[model samples]
Target: MMTLRRKLTFLVALAAAIPVVIMIGLTLKAQENLVLQAKGELNLLMRTNLAHIARDIYALCDTVNDVVAKDLDMDLAAARRAMAKCGAPNLGVESADWDAVYPLTRQARRVPLAKFMLGDAWLGQSRDPAEHVPVVDEIGREADCVCSVFQLMNEKGDMIRVATTVLDETGRRAIGEVMPAVEEDGSPNEAIAAVLRGETFRGLATVITNRMFSVYAPTQDANGKIIGMLCVGKRPETIASIRKAISGIRIGKDGYVAVLGGKGRFRGSYLIAPKAEDEGRNLWDRTAKRPDGSEHHFIRSMVTNSVAGGGRAIHFEHYPWPKPGVTGAEIPEKTGACIYFAPWDWVICATLYEEDYHAAADKIESTMTSLAVTLSLAGLV
Candidate 1:
C-alpha cells in the first residue's frame, strides 16, 4: 500500500529527526547548568566585596582608635591635675559645690550651668555651652570623623556632652545634650548604657547627628574609677568612591548588593540601603508573602544566619520576591547569599531575581519545543 519513493522519504526524515532530538536534549542540560554557574559567580562576587570593605574599614578604624587612646591618656593626666586642687588625684566626675572648682558660668544650652574643666586650662567649652574644646576639635579635623567627650553628670548615670565636633542642625556643637540619661521612649538607652557598664563599644552608633561606625571607651582616673567617655567615629559610606562601588554592584537584572548592621546599636539598621526610603530603618522583621500565602521573614533569616556565621563563613538562602517594578505579580523563588563583616558588625548580601536565571533556561526550552514542531512538519511533508 506504500510507494517505494514515499517509504524512502520517511526513512530520510526519521534519520534527521533522531539527531535533532538528541542535540536539543543536550542543550537543555546545558541551559540548566548555566543558571547554576551564574548563581555561583554572584556568590563569589558578594564575598569578594565583603573582604574589600572589611580591609579598608579596619585600617580606618585602627587609626581612629589609636588617636583616641593617646588622647585619653592626655586627658587623664590633665584631669588628675585638676583633681589635685580638690585634695585628691581621683575626684568624682561631678561637683556638688560648683564654686569650689573655679566655676565659670555657662550659656547657650537650654539652661546655663557652671563649666566643667580639666586642670583649669582645657575648658571643654567656651563660655557659651555650644563650643568644642581643643582636643575634640583637633581630632575631628585630623581624622575627618566625629569626636566627642561626655562627662558623667550625676549619680543617675547621665552623660552630658562636655565637648564635641558633633553639631546640631544650626551647625553648633551639641554641647550639654544628654546621650544615655534617657530615651524618647522613656527607656534607658541601650548603647551608651552598655558603655557605662564598663564594656567597650565598637560598632555602628549615632551620637547627636552623625550616624557612624564608632568606638566608645571609658576615661578612668588613676584609681580606675570611670569618670567620662571618649569616642572616635567615621561614616562608612562618606567616602564617595567606596559608596559608588557598593551602590553600583548588580547581581542580575534588578538584583543588588546591600550592607546592613548586624549587632549592637545598629542591629538590623541599613548602612547602604538600596531604597533611600529604607535608610535609618530596621528591617530585621520585614516579611514577604509566599505563593501559598504563607508569610516569610526572609530578611530576618538571612541576617540571623549570616551573623551566626561569626564573620568566618557564608550563607545561602532562597526567598520569594515580586518582579521589580511590576504590580500584583511576584516571583516565587529568589536566591540570596550573605556574610558577616566583623570589623564593622555589618552584614553584606547579594540577591538574584528568579527571572534573570530562569529566563535563560526558559528560552532554551522554548526553542526546543519550536524545533520539534518544525522538524515534525518537515517529516510529514
Candidate 2:
C-alpha cells in the first residue's frame, strides 16, 4: 500500500475523478437553469395562446353586440305573424303558441313577399307586411360583415340559424333546426341555458362539428320581456395553432408537449392539439401506475393545479408510461409542467425526462470507473 507506483496511480485516478465530478456538477447546474428557463418560456407560450383565443371570442361577441344594437328592431306582433307563416308548412302549426310566441321552424324559409316585408307600403300590397324577413336579413348581413356565426332563438327555447356564417351539410342556412342548448353528445350546456335565463353567456362551445369561442346575449322586446337570444361565435383555431407550434419542441428523446381537456367528465381527453392516436383516450381515468407501483393520477393533478392556480403552470414529476404509439420501453422518469386555458377548458403540458438533465452524471460515473480500472492495471505493472 505504501509503494510509490500505487501512490502515483491513486493520485492519477483521483485527478481524473475530480475533474469529471466538477464537470458533472457544472453541467447539472446549467441544466437546472435551462430547465427553469424553458418552463418560463412554456408558461408564457400558454398564456399567449390563451390571450389570442380570448381576443377572437371577444371580437365575435363585440360584433354580435354591435350588430344587434344597430339593426335589431322587431315589432313583436308582426314578427310572430311572419315567422309563424314562415314556419307553418314545416311545424304544422296552424297558428302561433298559446303565449302568442311564434314557433320558429327548424330551417329558415323564404318569405312569400320579401319586398312588402320591410313596411314597404310603397309596394301597395294590401296584405300586412312580414316583419320577420327584414330582421332576419339584417342579422344575416351583420354576420356576413363580421365573418362570425350567428343564431337567433325564440323565447320558447327554439333556436334558428337566422343569419350565420355557419352552414349546414346541405350548404344552406341551418334554419328550422332546433338548436338545443345541450351538445350533440348530450352534455349539459350551462352557458346556452344561461342566455335563455336572461343572463349573458360567454365561453367555448361546440358550433356544429367544431368547438368555438362564443357569446350569447338575451334580446328584449319593447315591453322589456326577454324575447330571444342572439349569439355570435368564432372558431378557436388558436388552440390548434398552439399545438402545431409546440409539436416540434423536444424535451427528451421521447418527451413532448400535449394538450388535454382540463375539466369535467371529459377531463384528460386529448383535444385539438394532441397526437391523432391520443384523441378520445381519457387519461384522467387511466389505471396507470408509477415505477414504484403506486397509482398515479397524473391527469387529475394537471387539472386540479391549473384550476387552483387560475391557469398558472404547475410543475410535477412522473414516471413515463406508454402513451398511444409510444411503448413503455426504457422510459425514464419525467418532469412535467401544465397550464390551463380556461376559455376552452383545456390544459397545455410540457414534459421532459429527468435523466436528460443528469446525463452528465452518468458520463462522469462511467469515466471514474474507467480511470480506476486503468490505475489499478498500471500499478500492477
lDDT for each residue of candidate 1 in 166-256, tens digit (9 for 90 to 100): 7666666666666555544365655567677887666556655455666676766567777677766664454334546666777657877
Query: Please, what are the lDDT tens digits per residue for candidate 2 over residues 172-243?
Result: 444333455544335655665786678866555555546655566655534555544556554446335544
TM-score for candidate 1: 0.63
Candidate 2: clashing pairs of residues: 105-176, 106-175, 106-176, 106-177, 107-175, 107-176, 107-177, 108-175
Off by over 4 Å in 2: 1-163, 175-190, 193-199, 236-240, 290-294, 313-319, 323-332, 367-381
Best by lDDT: 1
The lDDT values for all models are 0.61, 0.50
219 Cα displacement, candidate 2 (Å): 2.0
- Name the regions of candidate 1 deviating beyond 4 angstroms: 1-117, 120-134, 138-143, 153-158, 181-201, 235-241, 290-293, 323-333, 367-381
Q: Give the least accurate 10-residue stretch of model 2, judged by summed lDDT.
A: 120-129
